[model samples]
Target: MIHFKTLKQANHAFMLLIFILSSLFLSACSGQEQTKQKIPIKDEKTKETAVPLVKEWKMPISISADQGEFYKVIGWLSDQQIFYVTNLKQSSHLYLYNLITGKSKLIYKTENPIVNVQISPSKKYLLIHSSPSSNEGLVTIIDSKGTELLKKTFPSYDLDFEWNPYNESQILVTKFAEDWSFQLNLLDTKDASTTVLHFPEPFIKWINKDEIAYLNWNRNSPSLDAPLSFNGFGTEGEKTVFANIIQFEVYRNMLMTVSANKQDKSMADYSFFDKKLKKLFSFSIPQLSNYSDWLVPFYDYSEGKKQFITFKPLTSGDADTYSEGFQLIRYDLVKGSSEILLGGLENVPLSVSPSGNAALMGNSFEKIIDLNEKKIYDLKRND
Candidate 1:
């Protein structure tokens, strides 16, 4: 009887342990299933969505020059056509390329270095300026197909030139002087007669056909100097003055200029006259260490859609890495910021088509990137 009772108790204990073990295993599986379901729900929205990526072209050219070698894409006529000049070119020749038809031509080849090339607002004329080593500089106007229309030689050096959007017949050319002196010349292409506007110093800008903005400095104590005043010229050559100013720019009728140079290397000013130059403001850039590089392009705001292009050096690393390379950034002034339209290009010569639907880009390298779609459209190999 005792043996039987002991066996029965042992069996009951074994049955109790089995029941507990099965319950624990069931709980664990249920917890695991709950966690798996939660994870999918948390990420369900993202799993169904996609993120866009910025596409870029591998520009065709590989640069071999050391630091300080001069290279930049100066002008682009269209997405399929481009104009580029290099210090290495024979006299920095301006070469033209049409990528669609695979035809390239040397439009203007000269021994004198070309400082700048600009296409007229109408896209009918290309203005090329040559700064010779021996002779004074001259402005050469040519047709798109490489026919020379006319050439005008300056009495002194011309630092900058711009074509008027309102009138293709009128061009504004700046005659820069040593020690911060300059003059403005209005050249009529049709008649080839130049009208000179004498400014006491470098001008901030001409706001319109009737108004011009220029700068002036103050001589404070023998070595110390402060800003004195800002001046404006009216249609009939009338003068207006603003005191204690440094730098300025004019858009439409509004003028804004720099009043203080405490932190910024550059600032812009403009005027408010017959009409207002809206969106006119100025500020200085903060510095990195004691070294910084700044590039300022002459702003064009006369139209609804304006073009802004310049060679901006990379400021993050050693000059050796970037001296031979530069990026071309363009802004639709109507729109506020610049978009990375092209890269991996040397001497970015750009030309926008008359219809504004297409543009042409050329560099020392054969590949040209399309800014609108961010793709490689042309790859030209040198013979």
Candidate 2:
């Protein structure tokens, strides 16, 4: 999901943050700030609600602000174990922490700071990415135990990866040069062989077992939205089924998209569809008038709860000018209703826990949210 080839990047911190997050959702840590904003609710249905925390504990990690060291709460390896990384300038160490035992095991170590770390869809393998040069990247693939399986390097200025949910051993990797020239390869980890996948777009997600979808942008024409196109692995040709799609993401069984609302160009429509490409439902968020340059906010979908959550502002405005922060919203896919959960926080990245009970927030993963309890707690070093 993190890519830097677009004209929109322009050496912005937000663009860099998005890329770092997309690279296997590299995990975060720091002196936790409790600067949560208590913005007033517009309606009674989505008003503020408070509940006492049932459980509270420090995250088993620390940060050295003096040294500019940081960390990320990458994701939950299991309900009890969290996968994280301590990032220093010269080195980075990946760890798996067990909440029950309050212990962490070193998974892997790299000489350069880890830029990205990803777990396979089934949680069977780990992929760590590090940048050793401006145009070269080193990748380390390991099993769940941190046993090295493969290490490869790519000559790319930017990169994106998609783990085939149906085929855990096969990975789709796209490598892009500084000029935005790119190549897509289907990697067979078992044999170290790659088959060139001729795709036009750099950002593609597996829509189903064999089919992949991408925003088919006509780079020459440079339109605001692209056709959401699809192609199968064994098929020769491609098909453009939907139009005017700005962004799209595919999760376990849910396919999501962001596009300018057909009825109102000022609103960005968020829609969900099944693997069959059947439209499920959609809602809209305020979008800037210039749809082409609109920077969509961060969002994460919870597979277990069938919930779509994102940070959104109440009013549409310029993307970067808003210092007031956005509200956290949860759209229930099953119930077809939405609720405001939290508000007045920067547009930072967030990932939902697999169980859908908690979420880790901030670039450093400095805050933890109790989704069920409606509370946010600082995530700090246990010591």
Candidate 3:
């Protein structure tokens, strides 16, 4: 071939070899650029951002003690005033502390111990309850000035009650019947009048001052597939709102429900409905490896923001160490993304501020996170 090839043929063969080499070189360079781009993205995803440290406040002298300890935060009445319970010298007392003044006032004192305390929405009344034993308890309504308005004794079995959010004068109470079924009643605080409703498996919630919504088991239904329904009952009469519901919750003005899936019993469709039971949006969450992991919604229905908070475990171990504990994540519904607020919060949050800007957390110490600022403050006792 070397002896017989013409000049033109040799030139053509040399150009063909050059074209092949050029293609290979270009491909290799492009692949290297792509690899370099991918590595930075992977690194960015894995990098952990440092949690910012904000201002720390000394635990007001009111709740701090050397011998006794503060129990749990009841709630925040205002940005500066907080309600909490404490046990000192074998007696429990409710105390209201002012953050600005660094002073605390005794709201109520008791020797039997305050089991739970719920403040009214107006912050004028406190609903206090205490259980003498496992089977007996008493509910008392007291003003912020410690004036008793109403006190009633209730049996410990199947006793559940909720205050009417719209009207402080009324409350919805539930008790178990002899057959282990639950009964719902509307209680009037002025005259102690109770009107029993003819609803079974009643989970009552006040939609407004004049309206209420509840979930009931549909025993009259012929099909087993749709055994539960959500209903609105009041002076207007009872009307079925939604059906085939496995779980439902009424938060502010929005209704959230989980519908049962016929094909896959383990799966469910969670939907948000309006007051009229019209579906707004729907989604499904994945199965959790640990059932104890919490997926909670932090929606400000008043403002109509769709946000949620989730607690995810970092490991499969029993005890969550400092470096390997549960993570607190704030998720945005619109963006479909999540941001880690805290990496190793050992315990669930105590309370989220009404404005949703801060959360109280800690086990042995008191820590407050300014959720909006992404900063945490360690609260210390001012000695």
Candidate 4:
């Protein structure tokens, strides 16, 4: 009877242990299932939402020197064509070069020496200014296909003209008198109409389609203390925007100004103003540094972003004689920060692409810099 009771107790203990282990295993499996249910699964849409990298491009093929003698670059007519001028012994010729095919075709030629060339913003027309004699100047408007549109002669000694950015048919011409005073005239190519304004200073630029900004000097005040005002002219007449502006330039809807310092003549404050005449930001630089340095607007403000590219001189001196190098810096107006793009550059930039993605450096061997990619390319002629 004792041996049978012991065997029954051992069997009962073994069954109890097995039941506990089975319950623990079932609990562990349930916990694992619950954890998996809480986790999220990735879908195809999530994988497709990643942003692509910016596109990279190689430099265009260089042109050979034997093709044509290029003196000055007028501008880029398109991404593939470049307009340039060449001065021969008795004539000046304008040529259009194809970047891909490495071929140049003469578009316009002038018997008189070419003084200045300006192209319309639409790239459909070009204004060629030439001086037939010391006191005689001729302005001709021509299409890109070498067809002449309009020609006018000016008896004045100094003649300068600029095409209206917004209007392909309007042009602004300045005629300087012998006394250094200038007269501003608006020329309409469509109707051959001309309007003379009372404004004297010719240092003006188009602010928009209908508005122009120019410098207005307060001659009533003392010569040394005369305040220079930034004024806007449109169909509504004239309006003063800012006072004591020493130098200014308008880029798209932004205006950059250098105001004279009354307290310190050796220093000046550079300021940026929006289209509504609201001050955005201001910084001070030595007056001497302004001569050797350059302030250029980088990207446009189409998407509400403002930035600038500036060249800071490593050493200060007269701009004409300064031998020191410079540092290229990019400044962000919103973040109020700056980054150095390049340093120890011996030459200043000769020209910048319209998109602001590239710049041509005027070094001993001219080089083109890809501003977005931070790459430099040799702008030499391919042999």
> What CA root-mean-square deviation does each model show from the true structure?
16.2, 23.8, 15.9, 10.8
Per-prediction TM-score: 0.51, 0.80, 0.64, 0.68
Which parts of model 4 are misplaced by more than 4 Å? 1-68, 219-237, 261-267, 289-306, 315-323, 333-336, 346-350, 361-367, 373-383
Better of 1 and 2 by lDDT: 2
> Can you rank all candidates by TM-score, best first?
2, 4, 3, 1
> Which candidate wins on lDDT?
2
| Tens-digit lDDT string for candidate 1 (1-383) | 22345557768777668777988999999999999999998799776553222132223322233211334444456544556555654466566655444444667766677777877756678898888643367888988878888888885645677676556677878776555367878888898898877655544455555444554543343211224333444334435455545445454434544342444423322222334424433323221121322233222232324544434444433333344455555655445556665555454444444334334455433344444575655443342
Worst 10 residues of 1 by lDDT: 285-294
Question: For residue 119, what is the lDDT in candidate 4?
Answer: 77
Model 3 TM: 0.64
lDDT of 4 by residue, 1-383 (tens): 22345567768777778778999999999999987766543444456554221123223334444434445667667644667777777588888766545577889999888887887877899999898988888988899999999888877788877677777798888888778678888888887677886664686788877777776755565332223344445444566776666677776667887765668755566788888879887765544433423332122221223656666655434656766666676667888877778877754544555555655555321456666676676544444
The C-alpha lDDT values of all candidates are 0.53, 0.79, 0.62, 0.66
Which candidate achieves the best TM-score against the true structure? 2
Worst lDDT 10-window in candidate 3: 294-303
Collision pairs in model 2:
27-72, 28-71, 28-72, 28-73, 28-364, 29-364
Order of all candidates by lDDT, from best down to worst?
A: 2, 4, 3, 1
Better of 3 and 4 by TM-score: 4
